[model samples]
Target chain A: MSIAWYLAVSGIVFSLGAFGVMTRRNPLVVLLCLELMLNGANLALIAFSRMWGNGDGQILALVVMTVAACEVCIGLGMIVAIYRRRLPINVDELRELQG
Target chain B: MSTVLFFLAASGVISGAVGVVVLRNPFYSVLALVAHLVSLAVLFLLLRAEFVAAVQVVVYAGAVMVLYVFVVAYVGGESDSVGERLRGAGGTGSSGSSLRLGGAILAGALLVELLIALLGTGLEAIGGYGAPYSPGPQSFGTPAYIGKLLLTRFLLAFEMASFLLLIAAVGGVVLARRRGGLGEEDERDLLTPLDLMRPRETGTMAEGVGGRTP
Candidate 1:
């Protein structure tokens, strides 16, 4: 298969993630969507890494994975904290930060 | 064979991504994400990035997914009830529905645009169909190769990532520790009242704790 097939799949995955992030009220779901987006980007990066015949993109994917780990950890912690506090889990309702 | 493998991985990726979105429960979303990540790992293998593929499976599918499932269980299904309740109460009202529609439309448009751009540009430069598999040097994507690159060219980034992970650990710990104390009950919780709706408004938290906090 050509690299375009991978890129196209990546794009579709990314768009699905974006839709989820935009529509989902649950912070956890949003976080999952964010993961999707990150992976979609990583797929493309790995593809390009193959095309250019280098390990740079693979290494970049590693760093991105680390960042994703951190983001998800903190995000889930916040969600748990929010739930513990009796706060609504809906992001729309948790607009205390709205300015 | 490679094309079939690529298609299989691609289908998994696309289907998993959709499942993550379409599934209502966060637990299911986590599962879908795991599938997605694992399929992505397969794709990485196709790309000849063996090490990254392995790490993707271990880190994303194994570790991160465990955390997600744990949180989903801890928070319980009630975590998602807030949305339905708000919708039932007409809390967000038409704006909420419109926002949902708008978001879906915008996302679809974005996908179309991305596909167009990718098909137009991304297809031309890279490998064409039926390209033979040419696995790169044996050293490629090995932990050793990546480690060397990290230490030499990306040394600063590597250190910073470790630092960031440390910070994230501390932050998660700080965020998780109850405001009152480890074992102590709140003598008026210093947290949870930031909402304009008063902590009692939703009545969602455990019966006694929220009432006592204020």
Candidate 2:
């Protein structure tokens, strides 16, 4: 449809993701929220690419996807480590060193 | 009709995204996130970004989320008191919440501004960018353009991404294998708490006095 509608949807999704990361204590949830934010950006980029008749934005979206994949790879590792250290994967309990 | 379809798809995406945020259980959040990804893919399709939409489904909803699900199940149950712990942790106090909300607003505003600026300039004429590119929606949406562009122009970045993934894989394995490896626990030790839930067979049926006394 219209580009404005896509942007608006992206904005709402990104805001929800931001709120999730801010409020949720679980690292896994935080990662999921981060994915939402990235996906929101991806949507906006594709919409812009379509409107502007350029492939640049689409290419950038591809780069973002690659980055997102890498992020998940590492984030999942961290989650597993957190689970190991505390026997429970809670972000609040993850603090091992705090001065 | 296209506009209506786009709106419906966008709303579906937004709802799933909100579910990802509002759900308490991480497992459900991941599932909702997958739903969100699928809806976004549909939005991409509506925008005529067929290649992008296909990649979105296969890469995100197919591969990435499966990794998430496995990780979540492997992590298993977490402490239900995590919220209380965070409240006491002194990290994301009330101020943090406000700042995060503000950050979200700021991001949204910036995105709006960008879109507005781009829109004011209006859509640039197609096939006018130096050379006449492929014609038709399908031609533009083919992976060939993307493939050549990424390989010839963005080759270095692609290599770097490969390196990053390599590191991530190694790190995940190392991190998962480190301390509390679960190797020391025997069947009996692991079953300590779970074993308590099982009901044992009674030696005599008559002991319960259901039919007759022994």
Residue B38 in model 2: lDDT: 91
Docking class of 2: acceptable
What lDDT tens digits, residue by residue, belong to model 2 across residues B1-214?
8768887888889899889977777888899998899999999887667788899999889999999999888877344345645654966567656765776676567656655654455544321222233566345556876677678888887688778778878876776676744566474464565557655444335445565433
Candidate 1 pairs with clashing backbones = none
lDDT of 1 by residue, A5-94 (tens): 888888999899999999888888999999999998898888777777677887788899999989997998898888789887788779
Instruction: Output the lDDT of residue A40, model 1.
Output: 86
Clash tally for model 1: 0
Across residues A56-99, which tens digit of lDDT does each residue of candidate 2 receive?
77788887998898889888887776666655566656667431
DockQ (model 2, Cα): 0.36
Candidate 1 local Cα displacement, residue B204, angstroms? 45
* Candidate 1: stretches off by over 4 Å: B89-95, B122-124, B127-137, B183-214
State the TM-score of the second chain for every model: 0.75, 0.61
RMSD of each: 11.4, 10.3
